[model samples]
Target: MSLFPTYKRFPLTIVSGSGTTVIDNKGKEYLDFVSGIGVCNLGHRPPHVQKALEEQLHNVWHVSNLYQIPIQNEAAELLTSTTNLDYVFFCNSGAEANEAAIKLARKHTFKEKILTFKQSFHGRTFATMSASGQEKVHQGFGTLLPTFEYLPYNDTKAVQDVQDDQVAAIMVEVIQGEGGVIQGNKEFMEAIEQKCRELGALFIIDEVQTGIGRTGKAFAYQHFGLDPDIITSAKGLGSGFPVGAMIGKEKLAETFSAGTHGSTFGGNPLASAAIKATLEVIFKPDFLQSVMEKGYFFQELLNEKIGSLSVVKEIRGHGLMTGIAIHTEALPVIDELRDHHLLAVPAGPFVVRLLPPLNVSYQEMKRAVEILAEVLDQITDKTINSD
Candidate 1:
């Protein structure tokens, strides 16, 4: 194999997509609940973003960050205006954004330690991997970057007990996407902010998967009414285009002065255009409200259809980021969904994660739940037979 065996990829090779469905190499259409793992929040080839990208194609694609890009400013303005933030540092992916956040926190505070929650996923780079709290992600990568502590995710008491003087930042996710779609406890999230204030540490929210209307808001942190010092975004920022950003409050601006951090292709004209157009769509009040309504309907529909099943434990998540916690292994269920013309992914071992586009229709959600209920019932039958 020429490529690293990193992803246990599905056998289907999707050739094209529109809205909520993708056509595989065999011309078989499948409902796409994955949404490129929450990167395609606007769904495939959204018209607004596509138009912007097409227009950018005729103008320019890339330019170094040293030169001012007009669209980059527009994109940054959109981000800051939507949130209580002041500045944005564009990067290429979620990992880079988190990496920049880490660097800025340490530099601004002149401290070394960062506290992340257990089961959290930051990214794969050495620094980001160290920031991640999962052991499997750290396996075989000896001698990680230092001064990161993993505390229990929703344990308010654990956060209250942290009395470290060297903490530069306390980073967390409002909803732990890869950690089994676990939503952070409201009290715990507030306590984290309080602790950051108590320790004079930067409060960082990793909105990589939960941002861009995924949780029916521009950013998940908005749901908890907590102000964070730093926010990292990516996955859904560019509507499938590769882009990331680290947004921060004005007080911490000077710490990331010139030459402190940079990316070669960060916030290039093309990416900026994509980000601008995407924000123009997703940041609107009506669009975000629609996502909120859809999410409520989808979750309610799932519960009505599959909640009473023998294998189902619970269905949880905010907005379009739904997770179905099942008693059985999720891989087989995911495969069954794929076979039945639906596409969902696993959050961990037992939770099936569904990230349909923010614009997914009610009919599409009902269909997805129908397929899920059918597959889960079939799995339950097999389990009973085996027993």
Candidate 2:
């Protein structure tokens, strides 16, 4: 069996990685800016994460939720203390975390409808895909879990227009990562909170991509100063290990009794160890502050170097999760950057997304900016000469 044919993968076969760089099968070193789609916050093979996993491997790996796992309790405590949420339901990926959140909202409110915004992406699960505002991902998935309504993002009026008491929850992403890294306006977020309160709907924030310090804040929702009834996190939670969590207020979390939901490998010993180590590192004041500083440095350098290029349109997003909107398609530029030993991913048709490791050094940032500048100059010169 030749692997499942799903992803249109890149040509290089990455064999190993360290810090913010990866080595392909041919041993070519490339700086990794995608961070495994915002999962590897501490970069590849962080010593603490590695040591924790190594130590756990010898002790025990899996023990179903049937038994008591001290690590699980520890992970939950660490996570809850870091955010406003009260409890955590650990799972394996962003989709599972979102699935739990959806279930919690429905169960808590005893309602059916869910309100999401346009250009939002929650996850790939059936319910999440249904809740997602992007049509392309839901295409052919066939009538999804019912009672989901999509409204225009950042439009308070659109949210206000939805008149449905059956609305169970309002799910949002403070920074829409897949939606070209657009951040929801503060007023827009406050408006949603107000509407949720008015309509008695649970407010949910999908922080899978923006959580765990990707947005300079521990959780992107904190930046808006708004409290959400439920929150989902995954990407960087375990720094490379698979771990997702649905966090909710104490009362809301209690809505799901024993059999209502459970995952066999969700909070296994090894995963918990990874989570603990990652949290210890990412939640540090100095580390997060550095991310904020580096993020500013990166945005400034990017704008200074290529912001005026004819092919560039705009730069948007906050902290480390940035998107560059270009006048031309971003795929060619992404591939070209790979040729120059840099890596980036395309967010939308015309936008290149950057989710570099939170600990990326200043020198690395300078190198990345220098390479991007050179590439943009070449592309511009080619276009001019052809004209």
Best by lDDT: 1
Name model 2 segments beyond 4 Å from true. none
Model 1 per-residue lDDT tens digits across residues 95-185: 9999999999999999999999999999999999999999999999898887898999999999999988999999999999999999997
Clash number for candidate 2: 0
List TM-scores for all candidates, in order. 0.99, 0.98
Alpha carbon lDDT of each predicted model: 0.94, 0.91
Predicted candidate 2 versus true structure: per-residue lDDT over 146-210, tens digit per residue = 78888989997887676778889999999899988888999899989988998999999999999
For candidate 2, the per-residue lDDT at 136 reads: 89
Q: Which stretches of model 1 miss by more than 4 angstroms? A: none
Residue 247 lDDT in candidate 2: 89
